[model samples]
Target: LLSLIDQIPEDQRPPIKLPPYDRFGWFFGRNESETYDGTFQVGTGADHVQNTGVMRLWNGANRTDYYRDTCGTIRGTTGEVWPPFGRLRGTPPNVTVFAPDVCSSVTLQYLDEVERYGIAGLRWIGNDRMFDNGVHYEETACQCTAPEDECPVLDNGAMDVSECKFGAPATISFPHFYLANDSYHADITGMQPDPNEHRFEMELEPYTGVPLSVKAQLQVNLHMRNYGLTLLQGIPPVMLPVLWFRQTAALTDELADDIKIILILPDIGVYVAYGIGAIGIVGLVLAIYFSVTRWKLVGPEELPPKRAQPVMP
Candidate 1:
């Protein structure tokens, strides 16, 4: 919807000047993630059970700049909020259930989704969440609503990057628009947001901590509020949710078997190398013994043979 109308004549543009960026408060992250709704050491031998505690942000916060969204910070403090693992506000549900090396039987419940992972050998996998395709709860990422709400925290059902994201007020909602609040859907025209059509979930293998199948489900939207006397005129006064997409990557059974083979081959190769080395070492010892005693250099009768010959002479 935005691509068709993005081109405005140079002279017909709005008087208000947009900043070089859309939002300029926070950074980004990597595979390094902090757990939510719990306090547990990652490598403490327990990764199944979830203990409730402070949420944390660990590693992979590189991008300090947003792509296109930018507004000069003057009123509210639009400062960078670094990711530190702590408190309810900091922990996101996505990274909370599982931590590296720490496998507790404790299952964590996030909103409508309860995380109950099943162990596979030495690792855990998404037994509970793998099939969790339905909408667990309402996703409210915006702060325009009730005062007591926590906005922008992922575990709160959605991830919000309004200021530091692409220009059109965007919020990433879970796949199954299951209980998408009315406020997010009421205004957009020509879009019928249905619960059944949009719901999505992920499948993960606990042992490898690798996503067996991943469908990065998200919804794109434009926050259409207060569009007075601008190019956005005639737009509805509501959050114009445009579309949602799920980017998927998965491991087929054959591919999964291939991966397992790939993972096992190296270990087998190492063991074979070790076994060959051991055999080679034993052979070397035998060869050295044979070479050293080839002519009976240290035979008990050697000294006597010389003495007996001298005596006989």
Candidate 2:
């Protein structure tokens, strides 16, 4: 019905006589209760550090058919968990995660060091490289098949997820288009991209890899285009912002204290063991020194004279 209506001239097109529910409810889903289930494989225990919480299979599959080439391949961890970063070794340049929503591995660059709840952590934020759409980063060329004059290439920092979202003209970006190109901002109003509010960040305790705080913000947009259709003639080709969301979490003080004890007490235990060993060694050395000194202090002539007189008798 929509395709047929789209073909009609805008002036002659039939009005939407049906009610709202009948017209658009199917887009949401079936009203009846149904179990939407999937299988997820996560790395655990000793394997977690090496595996870094790998999403081995999602819905019983290890890959996605969202893109044409390797871009569709499901690589990296599930983004919720990461390998324990060595504080002594310092922070890396970036971190990668296979975000199911984006249907690809996204990399967040190391922004800076941050502290929360009295615990220090490394903060990583989504940069222009994340959704570059091949403008600045050649590695992301496979993410989009549209020509250089496409909607996303014109506006960097937003990736077209239409293929992943079942052919819907959808795109994803940071909240308020934080790192997006100026062209996207020119089409909209009241969009203020502040790093404090709009930046998507993950702050993790470097030593234990615990998430001290996380603010994962993402905006979903409708890629509006006329497509030379009669009913959609006046629509401009733009990434229209539909809705934006921010998912946030922070470590509580109680949890922070528990983590401190869990991470710090072992080093204290080693120091205590070393102190006890040192005390025992010192005591043994003093005892041996005193015994030798006492034996030497007793004159040799006094002990030898007494022994010789007894033998002669």
Per-residue lDDT of candidate 2, residues 117-209 (tens digit): 777788898888888877787777777757545624545778888776655678999888888889888789988899888888888887777
Model 2, stretches more than 4 Å misplaced? 1-37, 68-70, 146-154, 227-230, 297-313
TM-score of each model, paired residue for residue: 0.39, 0.79
What would the per-residue lDDT of candidate 1 be over residues 103-132, giving only the tens digit for each residue? 111122222312222212111222223212
Q: Which candidate is the best by TM-score?
A: 2
Q: What local lDDT does model 2 show for residue 78?
A: 62
Q: lDDT of each model, Cα atoms only? A: 0.38, 0.74
In candidate 1, stretches whose alpha carbon ends up further than 4 angstroms from where it belongs are: 1-62, 67-166, 176-211, 229-237, 252-254, 277-313
TM-score of candidate 1 relative to the true fold: 0.39
